[model samples]
Target: MSREFEIAREFEVDATPEQVWDAFTTGTGGWLWPMDAPEPREGGTGPFGSTVVTWDPPHRYTNRVANVEGIAEQTLNQLDYTIEPREGGRHAWVRYVHSGIFVEDWDNQYDGADKHTDFYLHTMREYLTHFAPRPVAFTTLDGPEASKAADALSTAVRGLGLAEDVPAGTTVEVRGPDKGLFPAVVDYHNPYFLGLRSDDALIRVFGRNHWGAPVGISVHDFAPGADAKADAAAWQRWLDEVFA
Candidate 1:
């Protein structure tokens, strides 16, 4: 059995539809939403085209989005916005319609649609609510021992761009996977951090701060066979330059 599903969410942005439309159609605004690299153009790039399908100025704009990767092959997505006049500005209701079919099993398609809708609504709400500048944090660590490693990592993090007054008592030790060679362990603030590793090299970086204000971390592992010492020195210099 094959199944299909449809989902829709609505929001009221403080800006006018024209303003909202610009944001929706422009690359800067696209970053605020879910699109990775949105290029608004009709029969061009991005979810929406170049010109507005229903350009009612401060009232509404409806557009069709077809040029997606995986979803484009099986689905048709249309976004419609209806803006109503309000006290100080306009109230915008965004309706996203996704109509598609499943050539295989309908149950999975239905469940997937449900999940996708939930994610879509959540993403939209997050963008609208937090339309402000946020900070991005990166962290790294180095050391001869585990404890020293943690301290070195802390130094790297502070050196990068994070506040020096990052919360204390938020560090923990983590072990690397077994692959023959020196055992590797790390001090970390959160598990979501990224880690990179190679013979004679280890680096960790915290990507971005979540809404919860927790620091993300990543570790890099590297150890050269023949040029181990030189490789390690080069890695340290790279970190220094990046954090500096």
Candidate 2:
């Protein structure tokens, strides 16, 4: 039997409605992973081969997908984004909903998706408030099976030399593949996710083990001429070493 789920969130970003639309629509790598541009207007193509049901520019956008791959036992998936101007066009209030149906592993899948939305939205605010003008190169890597343990998140946190309950604004230095250190601030932190912001990048670490998945990391680079593949490779190597 399949069960339905809805994950709803409301937040405000220091950006206009137009800027919010661009962030959720065309500004792929800025807050989320990079992908093909969605076709504009109602009934047009949308993310993951979905159909755009509503397309009021700078206000509301929605899409529905039927029977997508990658997710197990998924039936129908829909995403809605409603934006409104706040502070007289300087900030935008956003309402987001991701609803879907899943079978058997409902609890695990729901846990994973529900928690991930917060981190992504937090990243969206970071992009709009800080790096909206810069182009982004994004990539993600999953840790090895060893990262599936109950304590995998703590392991990775310690591997990065961060405390289990680190606070926002704390600075941490992460070593790149070349052994050079890049300092980043703890922009957001919770039990299941870690967000870091640097001068030219945003880093998101997912503690997916709690939801029955391997840990993962996504890097959003805003530097000039950023390389996604190289960034992924470096992070993969780091995860391998961390779990080794």
How many collisions per candidate?
Answer: 35, 0
Instruction: Give candidate 2 regions above 4 Å deviation.
Output: 176-178
TM-score of 2: 0.96
Scored by TM-score, the top model is: 2
Candidate maximizing lDDT:
2
**TM-score for candidate 1:** 0.40
**Model 1 over residues 168-194: C-alpha lDDT tens digits?**
233323222221133322322332233
Per-residue CA lDDT of model 2 for 1-244, tens digit only, reads 7999999999888899999999989947888987766789899998888899999999999999988767667888999999999999998899999998987688878887898898889999998888996988989889999999999988887777678888888988865554557898989888898888999999888999998789999999999999999998888988998888
Candidate 2, residue 157: how far the Cα is off, in Å: 1.3
Q: Which stretches of candidate 1 lie over 4 Å from their true place?
A: 1-5, 13-19, 29-52, 65-68, 72-75, 132-244
List per-prediction Cα lDDT, in the order shown: 0.40, 0.87
Relative to the true structure, candidate 1 has a C-alpha RMSD (angstroms) of: 14.0
